[model samples]
Target: MELDILAEKENVICEMVSNLYRTKSNDDSEIFTSIYNQYKSIHLQYSELSKNNLEALKRGLFIQWYQKTEPNFLSGISDLEQDAEKQIVNNLFTVINTKQVDSELIWMLNYYNSWDWVFLNYENFRRFDTNLVNEANNRLPENIDKKLMLKRGQMGKYWLSLIKYGSTE
Candidate 1:
């Protein structure tokens, strides 16, 4: 399947996970576990395929992790209770660290990781490290239009606010 289509599917699945997490009902744990296991199965299958497929899988996993690890959710769950979540993140880091990835994919992964980090460390953002931001800025494509750059800047600021203050609105 095309990467865009796969990305859309990933988004849908991640949204489902997010909704399950937000529900806070008694059955949420069972439902979340089922969905997460299915996601991991699909992720492992894609990881064994071509680089593009792996990238899509990583992107989807990262999006789900980002949503689930939001400050509000993380406050209630201990890392010891999230073995699967840790494993998924560790797998993503391992893949991104490999030498097999091309420069473009590396840049894209770095951008996504850094953007997600901003949210993952929302409470401690004041003391957050700048290395990821610096790396993302350095990897930015040259000669990009001012409009696109502005949009990216705006997004970063918006995400920062959402992390530090809560809510996108």
Candidate 2:
């Protein structure tokens, strides 16, 4: 996806994730609904993110935003059915929360190694290390003030002989 629109929605994504924690619902359905809404918003904004990920990129925005900012950012879901997607996300949250150290070797003994893997490969992604990302951030639209105009392109049409459409009138 082009970094421009993603950058535009960066704040939006952050707030959505933050809402997960802000949500105090203990009902599994409520929790699931919240997650589903957030997921849908992210997916809608980026329908082309990946072929299949919630298998992996299914968490496209989640993964990208988390990697750059913070991981295990929020896991507000709870009491979901055993087959709950929350369980999957919670586990993801756990693993992501543990990425504090700067060592890949720290995960040598880890099992169930394939979480959040998009079923297909993605291309043209923006990374935190790239200056283009900075430019994209800078290019986000800002709030603008609009003004009312008093006249039209024809200068209000005050013609002396223009009382009727036909000159013969």
Candidate 3:
């Protein structure tokens, strides 16, 4: 299929994921499972496209979804960070960046990179607020990897700042 058509389809999938997140209920495992299955199907369909086209489609869809949903969706509570929908979207982004697209493509998307866009946009980003970060730092386990924790905390803070300040930079 053409890149435009594939992107449109991916946009639909993003909308579905967004709706699912918005309407999530307690004990939503079954709904999440079904969404995961649907994502797998969409992934398979995109696998048929040429690598460049697939990358373009993913990038286009990412921008489209961001523009369409960022205002309300970015700050809303959702299990998106741990959800299969995020996994699938991130997988596509990884594939496109590592396999299909070039440096320029990376530069373009790097402003609102996929990792920050998906993982950091979760409600949990608030946990890394400065007041809470110090408390979290004090509670860290002795045997735990402090470096990893610090890096994650920094990422969380960075993402939170971006959202709170409304600047992708």
Candidate 4:
């Protein structure tokens, strides 16, 4: 898979987790765990992919694995820009509505652990963190204006703050 695609998937899955958290329902934990588990597998695969297809995987084309295996997988979450967006939103809605949180923290921890994988693992990726140069090497395609990586960074900081001071809001 291309790095951008993986980054995009990470964005989608993170959005799904955030949406699940927003539902005000009791099932956020369960839904979070399920999605987190799927994310873990992808992380493992990402390592393997980074090793084998260093050049091609940067494109994030590897996400096709989930698209092929899971039913309405991406479609069940939120709307994506490159592919169909609403499918992901729907997928996320389905999971949260059906389950209860059992091991939600596990996924949350894994998500935090994987942060370095998405941002710090690449060669020219550091450039993106500084200035948006190297068109082909940018984590996201130049055409998309979503600023997802920025949002994720904000969310990550917020979560860490929650762990340190706690969320009073």
Give the worst 10-residue stretch by lDDT in candidate 2: 147-156
lDDT of 2: 0.32
lDDT of each: 0.43, 0.32, 0.40, 0.37
Better of 1 and 3 by lDDT: 1
lDDT of 2 at 67: 33
Once superposed on the true structure, which residue ranges of model 4 sit more than 4 Å away at CA? 52-169
Worst ten-residue run, lDDT, model 4? 127-136
User: Which candidate's TM-score is highest?
Assistant: 1
Sorting all predicted structures by lDDT, with the top scorer first, yields 1, 3, 4, 2
Q: Poorest 10 consecutive residues of model 3 by lDDT?
A: 149-158
Backbone clash numbers for all candidates listed: 0, 7, 0, 29
- Candidate 2 lDDT, tens digit per residue, 111-134? 112232421122321222232223
Clashing pairs in model 2, backbone N/Cα/C closer than 3 A = 53-56, 53-57, 53-58, 54-58, 56-116, 56-117, 56-118
Residue ranges of candidate 2 with Cα displaced over 4 Å: 7-10, 19-35, 44-169
Deviating ranges (above 4 Å) for candidate 3 = 52-103, 108-169
Residue-level lDDT of model 4, residues 53-105, one tens digit each, is 43223212223223333343332322113221222222222333443212322
Q: In candidate 1, what are the lDDT values of residues 99-149, reduced to their tens digit?
A: 444554454445555555533633322322343334544453433333322
